[model samples]
Target chain A: MGLPVSQILLVTGFLLILIGIWGILAHRNILRIIIGFSLIDTGIHVVMVATGYVTGGTAPIIDAALGKADAAANAVDPIPSALVVTAIVIGFSVTAIMLSFAIRLYDAKKTLDIDAITDSKW
Target chain B: MKRVCAILAVLMFAAMFLGLVQAYSERQARSPLAEYYLTQVPRELGAPNVVTGILITYRGFDTLGEVAVLFMVAAAVGVLLGSKKEQRAKTSSTDGKGPSELVRTGAEVILPLIFLFGAYVIMNGHLSAGGGFQGGAVVASGVMLLILAMPASKLDHGFLSVTESLAGVLYVSIGILGIIIADGFLDSHVLPLGKFGTLLSAGAIPLISALLGIKVGAELSVVIDRFRS
Candidate 1:
């Protein structure tokens, strides 16, 4: 059995990362740049999770069919799924904090334009 | 100047590519510990997702550091942007109009379902695709809906703070429990592993996921409350 869906997801995730990178480079607004960063983070998470998918593999739980004696016969790798949870939480917190920064920047400068906020006199 | 920057970037990228190729060609075979970890960790940990096991158990110290980083960032943002005087000033000026009827109604209708789905994701973390992060995000989204639908002044700050602190403390305590009760730090097998695919089977993963959900929800709510318009 081939994991065509997983492959597609991986490719799509890569495309999203590329698009997000482009957006980060091209956008002039700080908010859009932050959004691009979020997109890139999400794309990476998708790619990492997709890497763990095994064709015809069952969930990582121990199977009764194989019994306790040989429990490894059917499980797929559970590590990536667990790691992705931490990544997601980190990403959410980061995004929230970044958004807060964006709000503060907007408050200070009265502008969301990235070019307008540059100053060495801080 | 832009063209020069672009050319320099391309050259740097090419150099990195060459460096990566050289490194790959010269890399040694996997170590015995690496092979043992790859083969043995999943079976022993009873978690299907090796990454989850690594994050929550094997390298839990790193995960704790990551949470600290998040908390510090949040605190830094709060300190930098938040002032009692500024908050009071903004509140008076920006008693902004409430959310539209459509948004308010929609959010009210969907928030409970969203929260239930987040709980489901957290509870089934071991057996299914989701884990703490995904469930946490889902819970955060539920709070986001509430923030969008209601006034910031109306938000229950006390409840949010209690939930956040409780979750953070619980997460650390669970890690400590692993050290005290099990083989080492963040050893999830401290609790008895039930038959396997059941909700209670993964020892502490579901518990961690639940704590994560509450922490994320509180954090995101705090973030949203800070931005009133």
Candidate 2:
């Protein structure tokens, strides 16, 4: 059997997630970690939306020319597409908040290295 | 680096194999809300874009929450960074030579086009792929270009704040109007639906999109202004 587009998208998404995780875990810079977080979010959104796509499905919009039979024949789910828009907005806001925090941290501490940001002795 | 690459390669291979198997096994599974939203929501809400119907009507509370988060972030950033004395001291020390004439001219030429495109995106959202958030981002980027190309001293913080607050209040009030006039909060049929696939159709979707566009545009400009040194 031929490889499905969904499978390919899913595999690429998972790989991107792993890379993002690795970046977050291994990087010393706080900005790098934030970038990693964004990457992970993007990967998850891609996978979530890709899962909604069927092998042979039409766009969600109704066309009168298609008639009832053709409309019922193949149509991909629109719910995930709708949900993904929300997810994207939420992701953007979160990224903005995180970046603002990073800026504040830099302003107070004068450095971006996570290791140097420790205020309390441990 | 080599070890990391190797591990990544192995993980990729494993994930590909697993996804193939999973797709083969789970081919028959169906999403419950998928059909419900597609058929029922359009008929009840009278909005052609099911996505818009779901976002602004069925789950509008979530949209309100998202807008609140953005507002909170803007407020927090302002509070954290708003030290007028320090800013004034810093500005005085610098020579304050304004931006180059070329940059200012370029911004004057480009800003109108950007705003027009943003409006187009918001207006055509129901018919096409884009919506409020994307259009809002585009508008913000345009505002950013102005800040970059013009002198910082020329940027009016008061006007920006007024625009931002008004847009935000309008957004919530529209939702409340849905409650008062239509089914509930953010009901799409609060206004006339016009006809499907047309610019004036989808009732409140275009209105909400325009509101979101303005709010996002103003908020992001404020954010960019905060970081400009």
Candidate 3:
């Protein structure tokens, strides 16, 4: 194969991070910025899961397909998958908080533009 | 100037990560730690889903912390947008028209199915790809759908919070039970590890998954409900 699935996923995740950063820096709308933040979060999750992949490994589950005896050679790492589960949940909570903040800001200034809030400007 | 900076920053990150492209291609063997979990979880925990076994028992403390973080977010979001804007959000800016008859009818038809599916996912977590968080999200999405269908409907905040807190307390109680009886905190061995690859096979895992599903579903529903207004 030219490139393995894991590497492709890894590269795609990195690209998503860069795109998210550019979106965050270049956008003025708070909603767009939040979307960018979510993109970055997703990118990081992908990278972490990709890092745990083995060359020809299946899921870590020891079902009928992969017996316990063959688990070591056949299974991908479960740690990253478990951590990503936490990461994904935390990411959703953070996104929800960001959205609530965005709405609060919109309510106060009647605008979603970051430039509209002058009190926080350095 | 901002555009140039954005492009330059993206380019810099791209260049920096190019090394990863090469490093990731080589075949990698399982670490000793991974190997340990892979073999031991099935034998010791009797949960076919190794990931769920790890998440619910092995790294249970971290999962507890994650749940705490979600609880805080729900509370913070409540504090942030829960007051003063009720009338505004209730009125809704969408021309005051509710969802269409098709959506309402569809929601009425499929809402129960969605809830059942979420519960199944949570319950069968140890034997399958589903788990508490994923299944809990599925449940919350059902709540979201309910919200979407019935704009004027009100969620029982008191009931949801009670469910969330009660499930959390019970979860911790189970963990403590593990420490008292089994190897350590949140150990699955507290309950008898039944036959492998069945719904009730894993010791305490199905119970934990149920508790997690209930807690997360309640918390996320509260968050979603608060966001409604």
What are the per-residue Cα lDDT tens digits for candidate 2 across B103-122?
89999999999999988887
Q: Work out the TM-score per prediction.
A: 0.76, 0.83, 0.97
Candidate 3's C-alpha lDDT? 0.90
The residue-by-residue lDDT of candidate 3 on A1-27, one tens digit each, is 787879888988998898899889899
Task: Judging by DockQ against the true structure, name the best candidate.
Answer: 3
lDDT of 1 by residue, B48-129 (tens): 4444556667777777777677667657666755665456566556665778999999988899999999888876766656
Best by lDDT: 3
List candidate 1 segments past 4 Å from native: A1-11, A46-83, B1-43, B47-51, B84-97
Task: Enumerate the candidates' DockQ scores in order.
Answer: 0.26, 0.39, 0.82
TM-score computed on alpha carbons, candidate 2? 0.83
Off by over 4 Å in 2: A62-73, B1-30, B84-106, B151-154
Off by over 4 Å in 3: none
Residue lDDT tens for model 3, B128-223: 899889889999999999999998888999999999999999999999998999998988899999988878889999999999999999999999
